[model samples]
Target chain A: MTRAVTIIGLLLTVIIGAGTYWVSHEVERLEKRYAGIQSEILAEQESIHVLQAEWSYLNNPERIERLSQEYLSLAQIDTLQMASIDDLPENADQHLYRLDKFGEAVAFLPVPRTRPGDLMPDEAAEAMIIDAPSVANAGGNQ
Target chain B: MSFMRFSYWLRGDRPELRPEQRERLAIETARNRIFITGAMFFVGFTWISYGLLDASVLRQGNEPAVASGTDTRELKTERADIVDRNGILLATDLPTNSLYADARVVKDPVESADLLLTALPDLDRDTLIRHLSSRKAFVWLRRNLTPEQQYQVNSLGIPGLNFQREERRVYPHGRLFAHTLGFTDIDNNGIAGVEREFDNELRINNGPLQLSLDTRVQYALEEEVQKAMETYSAAGAAGLVMDVYTGEVIGMTSLPDFDPHRPGQAPADARFNRTTLGVYEMGSVFKLFNTAIALETGSANLNSVFDATEPLRIARFSIRDYHAENRWLTVPEILVHSSNIGSARMAMAFGGETQQKYLKKLGMLEKPEIELPEVGGPLLPHPWREINTMTISYGHGIAVTPLQVVNGISTIVNGGIRRPSTIVKQDGAPAGERVFSRKTSDLMRRLMRLVVTDGSGKKAEVAGYFLGGKTGTSEKLVNGRYVKNARMSTFVAAFPMQDPKYVVLVTLDEPKGTKETYGFATAGWVSAPAVGKVVTRIAPLLGIEPANAKAPEIEQALQIELRKGERKLASF
Candidate 1:
């Protein structure tokens, strides 16, 4: 009888001790999971913040305006140069409207040539004499 | 003897081979066994119930955490960023930290307050100590601290000091778009402009906010107008550069403007947006529309001439120009001279009702409906009469906001399409409704070209750029008196009249003429030259190359042939 009583007391002690251990183990596991989740949340918050700043930096107005101005030349229209269909130049090869207003056209000037033998020709000398008065006048001739 | 035996067994130290002893022993053993079994059952039941209760409690507490673990669980989401047309940042939200305190756990309130105040001098130490020593569990110290402030505060490392996550709205461009973009309140609530209009959607959505404002164009326009204001010594000036075709407001400036960051520091006048709000009687500039109305309504044609031999005498008013040419001027010459007499004659021919219809059709004589909150309604003559028509023909008896004038002129030049102005850049934009016939638009464009070519708008002409515009100067009404010294000078212009692209308008209020200007404060003297300068600066930037080559065809079509007597007078 003494031995049986002793066995029951031993069983009670072991079961209670094991139950307490299980509860404590579960509580510790939950604590670790909570801390992990909290850290993850904090990291994500930081990432969002960084993204917002970068987004704004990418869309800086002043920088974009300066770049477009340098490259596109987004300028005000010059009203004086506004010409109609009837205003096309006579000597132009094409009659198309030119939006380019900054002297983009290639221009050619015609120069009359004089004969090289005119130095020896008598008739040419007389004609040159008429123009030579201007040259003489450059030397302060009366 | 048996009972005696039982009692003996119950308390027995020794007893052997007795039937009573055996029976007593059996009964005592059974009773002990029953008590042990019952106690074991009760203990097991109590422990089982306790375990179930604890599990349920944990499940209730953990349900919210698990349910919130799905997609709904978000630490923080990005806010919409505000950007200009060229992808420049105007406004953005940055992640910030706020300092809080667990007042109950604060070991030394006096020390904590002193340390916090040292980092943030704006904080009052006495107030901080009072708050920290309160019985409340929690108290806020400071919110939306900068990174440096956060680092400094964290280094203090006081017990019970905590940090809460927050966001701070930052405008890196500062005062550039103060009035237009507007600033948000302390709680990040948009109080004005596009921010206020679309606050709800932005709060819910996470993306970048786009605006139609081209910062480059804005800078040029603002700089030019501000310079004009300075050069002319004007009280204030407003300027706008808009794409005639798309009606996109490329740039707009209203000085003196305030900064969005520190709005409280700016004066009320500095906060006023003159371009969109301030309405003024824009004198002869309205003649452009009056003549167009007479021609469009079939009341008169380009060949129709007004009898301007004398100033028309009304009941209490007489209509005349600053320097009226008493001779009968042709329709084109009337516009060239900016003759108020000729304009009044044209308005009389069209009459009052017809004039109102045309003015309304031109988007004048009404309030300017823009996206901004600061829009001004037109100040129209209460008793609409024939006199009003005559006066309004030369821009009197009527007042309109500058924005309306620019938009109205854009309609006339942009193939007569009345495109409501927009500050938004859509990917695939649609065409605006046609306001005037293609014929009228073309003719009006020719007339406008003629204005700049040979008329009062000559000062507004930029070489190689077909700049067409009109000049207007109205006597400012101050304290119920017409102040001659104070006048509002305005110049409205458009370029490449053959194919209109942009419309740039400038206006100066109460401008004081300088010695260089010969003490003349008219639009032709002040605003016209400013328009010319702006065109010169912005044209090269917009890729419109200046061609000095003669446009013989346009010159022929737009050239003026003087009358026989005028030609004879030229020889004199």
Candidate 2:
């Protein structure tokens, strides 16, 4: 019994010593990783601060107004152009169809269309269908 | 003999100790060893316990004490940013490098100065060389260097040259909000405007200080004011757009403004904030207050008529109508004609004390409460005589800031509630003190609408926004005398008058009469048109839908009934 007790005590001390060593080594590795992550965070924060400032500078109202005047042909919305929902006609869907038909003519004028569907209005589509042979002949001659 | 004794002891031939004496001696030695080990362990345990306690609690308490000692100076150097109501950055601190040199350590002062001069051509080469050769321990080379310039200087690799990290206050919008946001000094200290007003809060808080200014509205107001200034060839102009219910100033602009980035280079006039800092006798616009007070105190009603046929003389001072009609005028007609005589009569009915009490209640008697630090107090007539009442009723002999004028009109139109104006964004509708009854306020709104539809402010009428306002034209007072033909024209208006939301005021100082104006430089010809244009542009931006003119509700609320013969006079 004495021998057994003595052996067990010796084994416990060895196991505890090895466990302490492993834990200390693991802690050192994690500490290094934590330091690296902290530096990365600091760097990212600095870049974000710079980008925010640049974004504001680029989006200044004066500069945007000037650029819009130079490049865009849009006009301010007039009070007469606005209509309430109740002002819509009962056949609103038919009016939308007419607008869609108008959209087709606009597509052929070298203006970029906003969407892929409804490339041409009904009238333009019909005209294109009737002149399809002549247009092919002209293309052949060119 | 001693050598013989040592050899005997070594050989174990000395006289032997008795068994009991030997055992006792061994016990004494063992006991001494055990006692020493115990004492050492006790000392080691005590030290370990003390160290654990210090690490756990004592150090944490000490840490703040130590950090605060070193951090107070650092905290003053670091500042927070400022943003508009919509989170647009107005002011921020940019990390920059300031170049310095140790003159005592510089190896070749001439060569170093020459290189630095090339990098910073604006610096004087001789001055830099002198600084480099001064033999001082440290010297300032240049401040706020650009990154590219810093790189070029660093590439030169001159000895004794170093860089100290510094923060430079940058105003990205530059001159757009110069007077409102103000500017800081080189040491990042607040010196003027909102910066000076909220300096401590800005220093302690790392978050952005959000002001109530909307940049879009600010830009629009500034654009219109600039156009008006150019058209009229005015000396200066100021404008304000405020929310009547919340008392939040959405936009405020003063012409001849400077760039906050380089305030030192701007002239003093450019740095002056006219909206809050300059006080003027805002002429007939004060009549709006007079009429409201008259109705509120039951001194006059819509049917009450005052004879404006001739000038009324009071104490050697005669008040005459600018647009005089040779007959009696009703209360609405008085405001519509902008009759100074009629307004004075209305004030007389209410008496001088009531007028003073109403003006004080409307916050016109004190400096306006805005976030700007340069607020001008109202200049009141000291004697409080009867003539002062008559003159002040038509907006003369008493001077108030443009901010106060707008705030007072807002109170009259915004259900008679007086809310102190602020430049800080508020979360919800703020409660205000009731200055006039709601019925009186509604009546005032109808009378203001009449002015736009039929009277002097006809030029201020937009197509569908239902704008209502009064115009004020006062000659600029110069050295105790009014300068004729050098007029300060002002227009104060509120939109969608049935339920007013915003009050806008535009003032032009000394607008020159142009050929286009038919040689008329009054508020109707100059400032009223500017107000109309501003309303047209900003109404849509603010998402306020235009109402149909013939809408039954609006027509009923703003309609004016005229007798058969009075219709002809109403058209005037």
Query: What local distance difference test score does each model get?
Result: 0.76, 0.84
Candidate 2 wrongly placed segments (more than 4 Å): A1-18, A93-142, B1-77, B562-572
Provide the TM-score, chain A, model 1.
0.37
Off by over 4 Å in 1: A1-142, B1-79, B100-114, B121-143, B158-161, B427-431, B479-481, B552-572
* Model 2 clashing residue pairs (backbone): A101-A121, A104-A120, A104-A121
Task: Score residue B467 of candidate 2 by CA lDDT.
Answer: 87
Give the lowest summed-lDDT range of ten residues in model 1 chain B. B563-572
User: Candidate 1, B430: how far from true, in Å?
Assistant: 3.4
Tell me the alpha-carbon RMSD of every candidate: 14.2, 13.0
Kindly give the stretch of ten consecutive residues in candidate 1 chain A with the minimal lDDT sum: A111-120
**Per-residue lDDT of model 2, residues B248-278, tens digit only:** 9999999988989899999999999999999
Candidate 1 per-residue lDDT, tens place, B149-230, comes to 8888889888888999877777766666776777777778888776776687668756667877776667777778888899
Model 2 C-alpha lDDT versus the unseen true structure: 0.84
